[model samples]
Target: TDQVQEVLEAAGKVYTVLKIDEVSNLGAARIRVRSLLAALKDQADREAEAAADAAAEKRGCPAACIDLNNLDKLVPASFTEKADGVVAAAEVEQREGASTEFERVQFTEEMRDAGYTILAPQMAPYHFELLVPIFKRAGYNAVLLPSVDHGAVDAGLKYVNNDICYPSILVTGQIMEAVLSGKYDTDKLAVLITQTGGGCRATNYISLIRKALKSVGLGHIPVIAISFKDLGEDNPGFKITPKMLYQAIYALQYGDLLMMCLYRTRPYEVEPGSANRLFDYWMDACKHQLQRGVRQSEFRRTVRRIVEDFDTLPLAGEGTKPRVGVVGEILVKFHPTANNQIVDVIEREGCEAVVPGLIEFFLFGIAGGIFQQPIGKSKKSALGSRIGLAAVKKLRKPVNDALEKSARFHPPADIYELAEYAEEILSLCNSMGEGWLLTAEMVELIRSGCPNVVCTQPFACLPNHVVGKATIKELRRRYPESNIVAVDYDPGASEVNQLNRIKLMIAVAKANLAEKEAEARAARDAARDGAPEDPEPVAEAVEVETTEVAE
Candidate 1:
């Protein structure tokens, strides 16, 4: 009773203690507990709905007044004012047409064939490195831009609002800096940005890029929007064909496999750069195969060869080492520049880094559409989302199968399984940026034997705060042995402070690992001596009853 009361207090749930006589037997006590929990859950739900209603009212947009069907038409008046300085100028340029000598040029199929270069920002080096070769093979002069740096951040800050998310700033800055550097012919170069078409501010990134380009007197250079949705409907020239989409998906899967292999082998390799060299070899081989128009049937063979190659690398002495899993915002979690090379830092600290596969994110986007069906009025919209998800799953099977067959790598969890893990803790309807997917990744990491997790989020991502930070206490309650820390990355945040916190987590990981090893050694020695083994005392498990609360 005391333990249950303490847990309720810690979770911030208000409950009155029941007299012992009032709950006379175990069954009666259980019934009382269930009733109290139900009441608390109802109270929480009511409060959450009231808060949401209040927020909507304060914003002066009634729930019914906002059209979910068309997100572009629902921009509030206040948002328009905040974005006017940037968006208005771009809109003026767009309406003026190229006859007025506007700098922005649309990238047509003709431009692609005419040797026009397209630059894409680099988020994950290994993934982008492999992905670039596929683009080259497809006859698109696509180049992954250089790593983000202080210069990119400065350039981003100059044109972009500082209050915007850090990734937007870095992406805009990297492109603008590249353009101004005279690295490519101004007439033939274009920049590509992704449009999520969601409620999050990320949907505004394409607009931000256009505004920045116009401000820099480079409005003539086309800003291509790459998205699965109809957000880029106006850009007919930058269309993605079925073959191109198929190839890109395979490239992403291959990149994920290589990244996993690299992280698993690099830390303990006898030669410092052998794993990297082999990685480059496989990348080149895969690119050549892709160029030759290798059939999907050959993908499994390719995966096997790549795994066999990595297996040949000489590894140094290794026992169980500290394993740290990284989960957070897409850009900061994978980009070295954004997170200050966190994976490298973890490796340097003698730990193996485990990052979830990028395919999971694509799956998350598909899942989001399905999750939102309940809120939408159109059955057609729900049907479209179902069809889209089914097609993606069909396409994903070969890649998943290949990974599962590989002996040296860990297979990614099925999308449904990930969603199930998330459903256990968070509501499926919470489809914000990353949303339930972030929580699912944390659960996946803990279950996969990497309990020490570093959740890296940009300083201003609100979705991350709700899904990442807010869910940690509940996660800890369920997995008491989890060693987790949330690290915020921003221009103003101190690197020293981030590193210090990570160091502390690492210290705890090392101690726990040492203790486990000691216990194993003791058991083995006792068995070898042919003497009566001392009985090991078992620790009592603490039962923490918790109700799922949506944020």
Candidate 2:
């Protein structure tokens, strides 16, 4: 037992050194290693238990569901096959002669009468096009808001408190400002926002925007929160129709695939705007397919054609530019609510900004539901079914595959591994949400390959604070060379304060790079002198010490 303790101590020390020496992201790496180790142990335990269950079943006793509370069983194969059948049957619901012609003509008249204009978040062109017809079908004028710009951002920064993400303020500001500008009647115009009610600032954005409106005395205007879930209870009630939900989810999946391809091709193209242009063209094609109710077979052919076209675009940007991986609170990471025009800021700093999409978060949510332990007979019986098991597995695969594929390009850290780390953290804390995973992503991304990370959360957001505040120390201890900054956005946070903090983080990143270069130079000189390099030893340090250094 003494010898075993010594071995563990030795392994821990080596783990610390290897983690620190190879990457500048200490928090994510340490968390990742911890998670991976736990996952390995969990997997071993599951396999053994499964084997025992299989043997018991062979002896004629039926295999009982594993503790549903502990492990989310995959949906059984039978369910997957049945789900495929359901999907196929639903495809037949597409109308061959669905007449939007009458609705379009009527909407055009209503728009002229009410002076109503539709506003959508600045989404990929593909998404916008698909959404436009849907909004039109619902009876409104719609256009994707222009990409966020500096002037609009500046105005929003002036009014918005420093603590809130800048982009949300600007975009909301733009919408509000547009209403006030008399370009459209205040009574006739409305803007749309999406709500997930998930673990992020996005869930609260509608309230923030509404409050902002009230402050500006624009309280009469309607702000629509298009929810895929039951998020907003106070606002203008909009029940999601089955047709609407189906169309919206399909649009989301289609947009996700296109965005993935666009980013992948953008970095390697030979002609600037080729990818963007193809994206535009594909959006039109996708809209046509969806509107005409084209079969899946036809949609696949169109996607293939789009992919081929994307390959022809030129990669115009600097290929070797430093890449900054952004993680943390899902909404803030993807939506502007958390990060405050961070992608633009990073681009201005001459770095490529990579953000994980919404699909992964959705997968997390669904799988999280499955992971819930069964409380009674219903849950146990449900878990015993093959369909339930297969459903969970199917949902999990896309996210896992995407994570692994994304790692190949950016290679900073393993987020999936970090998920387990977060799971363990939640297990210990008896909690789960965007907070635990967002914090874990910070540690994982840094460990995987990205030392520079910006974690955005809402001011006074307890869960996010719990995840982010403690990471400062862990980050430093594991990656003394890593650069991380947490930005909290609210109506009152000053822009200067947020930017100043980011500036400091950037400076640290630069210094870390400089030190790395110096070390390489020193190694080359030592080699010339026929001297051996001496590796530094590792030590166990508390989170506070690292945070102090960062401070």
Q: Which lDDT values do the candidates have, in the order given?
A: 0.78, 0.57
Candidate 2: RMSD to truth: 26.3
Top-lDDT structure, candidate number: 1
Q: Write the per-residue lDDT of candidate 2 for residues 400-432, one digit (tens) a residue.
A: 344344422332223345467656444323123
Error of 1 at 215 (Å): 1.2
Report the lDDT tens digits of candidate 1 across residue range 281-399.
88787777766655667876787777777767788755478999999988888888889999889998989999987877877887776666667636676667678768767766666
Candidate 2: Cα lDDT at 128: 54
Q: Which ten residues in a row have the lowest lDDT in candidate 2?
A: 98-107
lDDT of 1: 0.78
